[model samples]
Target: MKLKPVRFIFFCCFPLSVLIFLSAVTKKKPVKEALNEPGDGILLIKNTNGPTLGYSNKSGIKILSIENLYFKDLNKNGKLDKYEDWRLPVDERAKDLSSKLSTQQIAGLMLYSAHQAIPVLTGPFGGGTYNGQPFSAGEALASDVTDQQKDFLLKDNLRHVLLTSVQSPEIAARWNNNMQALVEGQGFGIPANNSSDPRHSTNGGVEYTAGAGGKI
Candidate 1:
């Protein structure tokens, strides 16, 4: 059947118009303005449809805004790096980060640090000194980073830290923040991967149950 010219053109354009309308309606909205929260030495960037990014202002890191979303300028190059973009896959991000590291930096990552204790214990095993004085001398706060720790973090580029005895949860949190700020300003801005040995002593009498979570 042959249709009139005007009616045929209208019918052909109607389907295309519907598709365009649907595309416009389904398109994602751009992110809203970041809600900035500045506390202690950290700045938190909150977005409606994006990841929240927290960075230490003292660390010399800056924020990179792309497509109304925020990202940390970890290398401080004033641009978004692949590793710094949270949208990328984990393996892709790891590859991008590994490519940026030098041989020495890779070696440093391989090196696992000795057991460290928060508040710098006086015993020989996990003990550390602040400045030249032991932590027991009351010369420094329990959260203060030891001179030895600073040396390893900066000079040796050590990213892995083994935390042994944390004096208190509060003290441990403060110490972690301090350490993170220290390395966030350095090359590639890699934060410390702090770990601890099994701190919870299990009861011999209790039987293990699958998917039963227990407090530490």
Candidate 2:
């Protein structure tokens, strides 16, 4: 009644294989938990397998947890929307968001704002008023958003902003954060897409027509 070599090896490995499979089936990834309290300004939720999420508590946005991963509830809805889920492809998320926008919101998204300057310059090119007075009147900080900027952001829902100048780098950063916070609290939590003119050298002597190929 001697067992063959192949049968003996199979018998020896059968129980061990079953045990390994059972252990793997029972194992699960541990969920990580983090609490974001009010007044935290901007909080970062670190993820081991996904994107790091940044949300401002002051913006009325909330953190949502799904299968141990955290996402931003940008629209403040309790349920997670496709755009708010980072796991999906960017094109899918964008399509989902586009389907949810209203006519006015879509129109606003298409609008490109005029040139804006941080602290609002006093000159004719990019000048603006703070609380109905010029920036040099000493009524507003250099980082403050001008009244005109606020009107375009809130009333017109304009998200595309063209920036021309800033008082300083620090002031520019502060103004940018302030503007983001303002818009993040608005509809759909859409942040402003700000652009600036080229800050480096320019050749004033060179000019070209729209249809021309080379510089004149």
Which candidate should be chosen as best, given lDDT against the real structure? 1
lDDT of 2 by residue, 5-72 (tens): 87999998999999998877765334234544333266677776877776665678767766667787
Q: Between which residue pairs do clashes occur in model 1?
A: none
Please give the distance, in angstroms, between residue 177's alpha carbon in candidate 1 and its true position after superposition: 0.6
Kindly list the per-residue Cα lDDT of model 1 for residues 1-216, writing each as its tens digit.
466887989999999999998887766434235646566677777855777877777898877766556788899898888999999999999999999999999999898777777876665666778898888889899889898899889999898997766777778888888899999999999999887555344442222221112121
- Each candidate: RMSD to true structure? 8.9, 9.1
lDDT of 1: 0.78
Q: Where does candidate 1 stray beyond 4 Å? A: 1-35, 199-216
What TM-score does each of the candidates earn?
A: 0.74, 0.72
TM-score between model 1 and native: 0.74
Model 2, poorest ten-residue lDDT window?
A: 207-216
Q: Who wins the TM-score comparison?
A: 1
